[model samples]
Target: MSDDRSPSTPPAAEALTRCDALVLGAGQAGGPLARALTDAGRRVVLVEATHVGGTCVNEGCTPTKTMIASARVAHLARRAGEYGVHAGKVHVDFPAVQARKDEVVAQFRSGNEQGLTEAGVEVVMGRARFTGPHAVQVALPDGTHRAFEAPLVFINTGARPTWPDLPGLQDVDALDSTGLLGLKERPEKLLILGGGPVALEFAQAFARFGSDVTVLERGERLLEREDEDVAAALTEALTADGVTVLCGHQALEARRAEGGLSLRVRGPKGEKTLHGTHLLVAVGRTPNTDDLGLDAAGVEVDDHGHICVNDDLLTGVDGVYALGDVRGGPAYTHAAYDDYRIVRDALLHGTHRSWRDRLVPYTVFTDPELARIGLDEQGAHEQERPARVYTLPMSKVARATETGETRGLIRAVVEASTDRLLGATVLGAGGGELLSVLQVALHGGLTAADLREGIFSHPTWSEALNNLFMQDPVEVPGAQERNDPR
Candidate 1:
């Protein structure tokens, strides 16, 4: 008798194709989540309108770091004479530096694309708008429409530079951060508006690259988010770098000047004109949530257009999630990566750790990188916690002395009674690397005594923390004796 289910019979292979997850805006978070889900035996569809890698790779961090490296080399070559080295005359070839940056970006983009393809994630290059809670309509390049439906949908469209509502500024033809990085030719002079990390970084970079740089801020000081002393130190560094920084200059109007652009800025004294070959507007960034039909999908957005996400990274709509810059948290790549973990756990495992468990650390990649993690003095004070502040100048650090980069300080804020590490600030050559120690101390729940007791390698910049915590409390002038530095 011939059996239907024989060994030679073809197996059940032709199953219906449907995705378990659909991720929009393939950036750091979305791209990795897609790969992780696919590895967990879930079918994933990752969609991107532009390149596979998002802004950070294509136009943000990668390009900025490349340009900064070029600037750093140029800076060192200029100062080689002071180090007892006879270096030849140096000239900055702007076009050549830009070309090198473009080469690096292109290689990274190609790698991102190749990785996505190899991961078996369907990378649809088109603008996708949510047509329903579980459905997305993608506008393909060939003028065709493709509808994808998945039970789990993730939005990670990231952010763009926000243009403010200053009158006539929109028609002034100014450049944002993205446009400024793509310039093949360097301007003779540049006028930058705002005093955040982007503004400060670009100001120093352009000045080093031989452009007469001027930064105009509406606030009372530069880098207002940092401590007053930290901002003052940075201001001094920028002034020494030949950047004409004008704080409290509220930009009123922008118009064409003699062969350039003129900005009418108002301050306490009066209105004055600031001229430049080009204007770089680095006010802030806004989430790219608009035009994506998030409202139709029942996803709630804050007043600033950022998607409202819970601690679990879930949107108001079930099975819909938002992460990265779109979620309106610390807009850093590492934070986005952590967000990926939270979403991945919620989707793949039974674990229930919230994104709030991660303490965010930030670093502004300047000459002396400004890095911070945990709460600062202000944050601790606001929480009504009795705090103690300690700081060590880089000039006293053995490593910084040997490296000739002793131009900053390391500061820590700790609870007086509990000794729990509250926050830290480091401004020095290895500020980025130094932040890791503070991050571990904050997240690992290590106290001041714990850090002071730890055996760190000698002659390292990080020894500053150990030295800082070992110091005696501030001495009272009238009632107490002076205590020496440990």
Candidate 2:
């Protein structure tokens, strides 16, 4: 039979929804943007192919952090004697932990859905593809199709785990971040094939859960984006927790072992086969722009499949924009939400708010946590910017000594001429929270002297900044110090 459906024609009026704004994905950006646009008395349609809240709420932050908390509790319980409390045999109930994580995820997802419904935004559960510059054809869940048209459209489809085309990798069973989170049973031995933030975080969590974990990283160190000292500190922390880290190693092949899975790895020591009960591939993430029909809409994507957006988050197509992980740049949920704000300001208020030169801060939820803001010591040196470097061991922080969590250190890079805080890294307990102090200070154009002499409360992690900035400048190799203001 000849096909009767015409691809160019728009759907009938009854089967099409025309709105002032259309949001492609109900992710971090889409959800809030949809609500804001709807509240502004504009008809908005928000479509989500999967669950709401995107990666942060569903698979990435909420679920993983919930389980990580449970793992932390288990670790603390085992270390009860260190705190002068005699707590016997700490047991980890894997199923119970998974259940709690599920509960948390469901609650957050439900809350997001309810909020969208209450905001008078039309929430469509379907996959969206651009049929024209200003129109999309949605494959609805009910085995039906609908078309949506709007002058303003926002794409926030986010990203997914990138599966590399390594030989035998696809044949053997491997878990990504999402699959690892859904695990109900504790793996006896876990083999992770990356040393980035996600890989290290999961490595620590699983190790604390009593799993013999080994991390194989292709780069020279874990968290390669950070300075070498920072990466070494994290490596030390992980090693102290019984994680076998193999840096400068590449996964040559994967095969089914007798009991579990076997990974052939090649490093400086030569090829070695590692066996594990579970294998997790936490290499990286790729934007979900493959099936978006971006070409039809005249929206361009970069080499990595990330939608190319201008500084204002525009996708080159008029009234169309990209946000969050799908638009590349910083793949944090906060960055995505900020993209929404930038777009909102441009479209709603007609203001030109650029998404450039903004300070981006992030944290890795390891045992002591690793948090950073702005440039690192290496970045300053590479840029040939003269700066004063300061390093303070966690042992110097009273809170770290008292808490017995002094495994990491704090490092700060400050411009010598201006005394302005160029960057800071907090690697001790509550590092993410403590990094915020420096973040605020830097954002307000505060200098190292300001932080050094600030009256910070004693016996707290934040107080470490006082000692960090007070230390005399240490000359780093290949770094020329500008004239010190002091």
Candidate 3:
């Protein structure tokens, strides 16, 4: 099917304003697309439904990480006893923490707004709906509406938290990630309803903030998408921090309880009920594809409401593309950023940047952060390639021991016989930063020998990588030619 869908019958000026490029959703993807297009001397109009910097800067990463930092401080004060420091009666000001988070968000929000202005990109604050493949009608902040036309339309409308269809779930007054951020009062007892990154992160955060936290995961283990060891470490860390984790429990229903909320769950132990002062659901996200009129534009979305995009980020609709959470791959801030590069390159230079080849890394911003990139062991095995798993405990790293945070691991999955770096997972302090090196290794076509030969500074968190590769190896067929160690 042809992607371009500009209507042959044109309307008056009220219909559309022509531009070289029109971008939808001004978060990470839209903002960067606008700047790149503008820099390339193309007339660009950037439309945003809500704030700039998308969810990462506004809601997801920025605010959440800011909250995580507060939790870390609270945790440190509580742990001061081990260092011979008697920090008696520690108290956390929830209002102050929220205030600080707001301050940080506002400062960055203004900077993002200023950047777009400085770049001379037209920023339209409104909700945009597709009129045709290349036509859009936007509802402005005021009651009035405006329309625009372009040869190319890029959709980057980010995703939002989804409420699962559980019985009595709608009756209870609860919070999602977005709603949790707006909470003024600290919950006395909080019940988290998922075991993914967001759920576990919030669980640990609230626990450190003095809330009795309980996490309910439908899977047999936490972070079901991650490797088993990574999940186990996270579960142990959360349990140690006073957060009760209940895995393999399916939340059947939720209801209002005596001054709290109760969730009925079913598992091997049969039916069980969990009670808490507040309920926070971090199950997953739903892409904001609805009401955009994708059907009107001839773009296709899956059952989960994700836009069907190609490897080059092209949607079913011609001259229109989708990226980020809507594209149905990894939903990360940097993934969205990389999508911006792909779309911009295709638009400006006629170059094709395939996201498939690039190594996408993900990190959970918990106390002992968890980061992973490339393929896991199960992925490698499914691909029918012999994979080797290597791991080094965080306690073996001098820096981690010195920091008194030695309770995680660095794992690598190598393409056996070839010794090429396939994937790496780091779960501990600085895991986010450490994952970048692995991304480089994967993208740069480096081997395990390269990692081993590299000079990582002494007594550093990064040095864990060198030791991680020193673990056991696996055998892959036809890998002798590529087995030369660096």
Best by TM-score: 2
lDDT of 2 at 212: 97
> lDDT at 479 for candidate 1?
14
Better of 1 and 2 by lDDT: 2
Question: Which segments of candidate 1 are over 4 A away from where they belong?
Answer: 1-18, 473-486
lDDT of each: 0.84, 0.88, 0.86
Model 2: per-residue Cα lDDT over 1-486, one tens digit each: 764656545455527778999999999899999999998999999989999989999999898899889988998898899999999998898999999999999999999999999999999999998988899999878867889999999999999998877778877789999999988799999999888889999999999999999999998888878989888888998998899999999999999888788999899989999999889999999999998888789999989999888888987999898999998888888888888898888878999878887888999999889999987888987786778899999988899889888888898888877889889998988899989988999989999888888888887888888888778876543333334444
The clash count for each model shown is 0, 0, 3
Tens-digit lDDT track for model 1 on 1-486? 853743222224422225899999888899999988888888888889888789889988889989999998998899898789878998999999999999999998888888877888878888888877887777679865577788899999999998877766766679999999989888789999998988888889899999999999999998777888888887887888888989998999889778789898998799998888899999999899887877568889999999987889998899999989998889998888889988888778877778776678999988889999887765665565567877888888889888888888888888776788878999989798998988888888899888888888887876777788877633112111123333
Q: How far is candidate 3 from the true structure (C-alpha RMSD, Å)?
A: 4.9
TM-score of each: 0.92, 0.96, 0.92
Q: What local lDDT does model 2 show for residue 384?
A: 69
Candidate 3 backbone collisions, by pair = 3-317, 3-318, 27-54
**In model 2, where is the ten-residue run with the lowest total lDDT?**
477-486
lDDT of 1: 0.84
- In model 3, the runs with Cα more than 4 Å from the true position are 1-15, 473-486
Q: Please write out the lDDT profile of model 3 over residues 123-190, one tens digit for every residue.
A: 99898888788989887898567888898898999899999998988789888998889899899999
